[model samples]
Target: MAKERALRRAAREAEAAKQRARRARIVARRQRRRALLTRLMPRRRRTGRLLVRRSRGQRAGIAVVTLVLLALVWFLVDDIALRLVLTLLGLLCLPALVVVALGRRTS
Candidate 1:
């Protein structure tokens, strides 16, 4: 009975060790895959502050309007130099324009 008990205990211990090793391998493979994926397609870190404090919809609206205006300028303007200047000016003035246009009206 004593010998049989010792043999059973050793068998259980060996099975447990094999399970531990299998889990370690799985974990290592997952880690390696994650590392490779991260290296290949790294996520962009949002470290810098957004210039405009607006909701996603608001920002999208502003971008659409800006693009429309630029497109109009591009199509309507005959001179390349004038078109370039206007586009640059529009972009430069966008922040101030947004603030003024969307500012709270004090009654």
Candidate 2:
């Protein structure tokens, strides 16, 4: 009876050790996958950090669109003073539009 009990306990201990090793491997694999995903993914900037990157072509495109939109608004309005005000407002918004088009990034 004593020999039998010792044999059973040793088997149980070996099984438990195998289970522990399996769990450790699973955890390591998950951590590696997480690290790989993070490396591949693009990092996002915080809300307070609002720097945008604009290529030369993109900047020109934004400028052209802003001008065209401003011109259309000016042509639609009948009153000269109102047209001037709208144009000025559009001009003020030009930078903002470009910034939006450029897209925000941390790096």
The TM-score leader among the candidates is: 1
Tens-digit lDDT string for candidate 2 (1-107): 99999999999999999999999999999999999999999997555633336556766787788879888987899999998898999888877765676656545
Q: Against the hidden true structure, what lDDT does model 2 obtain?
A: 0.82
Stretches > 4 Å off in candidate 1: 1-52, 104-107
Where is model 2 poorest over a 10-residue stretch in terms of lDDT? 46-55
Q: How well is each residue in 33-89 modelled by candidate 1, as lDDT tens digits?
A: 999999999687664667435767878989999999999999999999999999999
TM-score, per-candidate, Cα-based: 0.48, 0.45
Cα error, residue 19 of model 1, in Å, equals: 52
| Residue 87 Cα positional deviation in candidate 1, in Å, after optimal superposition | 0.5
Each candidate: RMSD: 12.4, 9.9
Name the runs in model 2 displaced over 4 angstroms: 49-107
